[model samples]
Target: MTGRTADPGLIGLLGFVIATLTAQLEHLGVQNESPVFWIGAVFGGVVQVTAGMLAYFQGDDFHFLVYNAFGWYWICMPGFLLGGELGFFEVAGPARGVFSLMFAILALGFAFPASMHNSVLPVTLLCVSGGLGLQAAGAFTGVELLGTVGAVLLLAASALAAYLLAEKFVWRTMRRRVVPLGRPWIAGDPDRES
Candidate 1:
């Protein structure tokens, strides 16, 4: 099960792009909410997890951690929504604010490590962090504008992720480096400055 395969990062990034765009569009009121659940559950959750597993076996620990964490995040979202909808547990605005803030912090933490890979990864992670922060602010302050801004940021992040996927998978398959992600900031070791 481990001969070789297309870079798992491509699959994970594609899944993230599709799911994030769908959820953000719903938040922006451009689409119905129903589709978001399925997209998050299947594409974001399952597909990303699969990619993470592949990365793990391929010895790409960074991608494995990033993809797995985000995949689980997406997978658990439906459960949280269901809990609120079914009245299993009350999720007040402040609670949701706290949750979003925590996730934002987590994304920021990952961004530092992601920066070692390439410019695009760090930028993508920063967008995700910023979007989550906006969402938190919106929930906490009851401001619709903040949420709208967050959705816009998420949409932008999704576009970036899609481009990365295309660059990594499609162009590479064609034997060209069409979209360069830029040089890694950390050079040899991800933990040490170069």
Candidate 2:
């Protein structure tokens, strides 16, 4: 049997949306903190990292990096916070801002390359960057409004990621594009049909 593996993007995006939405909800006070960290560590961290490895095996360099990097982000954030609160070490408020800003930069780094692929991913990355930026701002200023808006942005990113997952996997069995994922922002033929 010489068949290929299923698309890792499906699981990756599934995990992405799950973690993003859950975290956003928790941030917005719609959920409790207890489940959020565990979800982030398991689905967002471990699962995404595993998916990224699968993507690498499939020769998808971009998705591979996206999944693993964000996966580690999910893992480390909770780990650091928990470690700090558990007396393992101290966590400074300023360090949170710097940490978030760093990831925001990293998310922005993928914007252009993602733009070359499809409209959704670049926009998704932009929302992720915006969310992280706002989160950083909130962390620095201690203003809840910034974080609230950031969580909203993350929710939007989650929705977009879900749509992308459907376009890639769910309706993929169809001959035509059942769930459209708009044109690439920077493709060779923007007007050309796929």
Candidate 3:
């Protein structure tokens, strides 16, 4: 099927990974400090790289595809690379916090785009937003406050898309309503007959 089709299972799986990682990262130990960071980095990096590559092959307008593919490659891949760097280890917390904002912008910017083409982008945006918001709250406020908000937003978007898809495919209901463009008319009134 085309990428445009609904993929609820995939969305659910990704959401699960995102939510679990977000939860695990909250209780940081020496061994497990930033587990969500690593998971997110890998998941995000691989996805961007893969999707970007696919976009390249699409051979549509080079500008948009190149922008999308390269943007992902630069943002997602580098977060992982920079996090793994030696200098980054010294200030891992601050570093991840700062760099996470960049990811937030990218994810949010693409959210509308994703919602337009596929259900994946919308969910991914919610996951990334939630995960990053958690990191940010933890960074600035010493509390993990945004996870619930993120999860809800992601879940809501998913439910909405699912509802739309169900209404479209299963129920086979009308997707739109168009009112006629004309003046109102009165029935059985002789003056309004014309």
Candidate 4:
């Protein structure tokens, strides 16, 4: 017990922001090809998983679950893509829709609890959930418009997550609440002392 607090949320959020933004760019056709595999594997998968483990050791259950879940999502996404590319299996459009839907549901499920934490958290989760839902719908219907919407939403979510990361890690570390995260939605929250 070093009595030291580990700020794994920062790293995890950073990983999420980068990977998500990269993917969104590809979806928007701003990038011709996705280099998401390596980025997701390293930053999203490895870094986030490490953050999850550290969060667990630090006794932050919320962060532990969030980080780990997203970490696995990042890790497995590449595997699925690679498998399809390698002809090991086919990744049909409907299958991709199902995959996106699953994560969208997961994000929504997590958003409720996150709402109790802080204003920024729930907002970020909601944006991400909405984006994922749009992506699922697009894949299912083979609609380009829905995918475009999803890409925009993902970009918004990434921006919000980046703000949260800066607030939590940078400003807080400097003992300056430079960015206001707003009040927690849950009234009379014990975690926050006003």
Winner by lDDT? 2
Q: Show where candidate 3 strays beyond 4 Å.
A: 1-44, 60-89, 118-120, 147-194
Model 4 per-residue lDDT at 20? 88
**Of the pair 3 and 4, which is ahead by lDDT?**
4
Tens-place lDDT digits, model 4, residues 13-119: 99999988887888898873347777878787898899999989977788888899889888877776677778887676888889888888989888887877778
Weakest ten-residue segment in model 3 by summed lDDT: 185-194
lDDT, candidates in the order shown: 0.83, 0.84, 0.43, 0.83
TM-score-based ranking, best first? Answer: 4, 2, 1, 3
RMSD (CA, Å), each prediction:
3.3, 2.8, 12.0, 2.3
> Per-residue alpha-carbon lDDT of model 2 for 1-194, expressed as tens digits?
24745777788888899988888998899987677778898889988999999989977788899999999998986786587768786665878889889988989998878887778888999999999999999999999899899999989999999888877774545535777777788864452221
Each candidate structure's TM-score, on Cα atoms with residue i matched to residue i, is 0.90, 0.91, 0.45, 0.92
Report how far off residue 169 is in candidate 4 (Å).
Answer: 1.6
Residue 111, candidate 2: Cα error in Å is 1.0
What global local distance difference test value does model 4 have? 0.83
lDDT of 3 at 121: 36
Which segments of model 1 are wrong by more than 4 Å? 1-3, 189-194
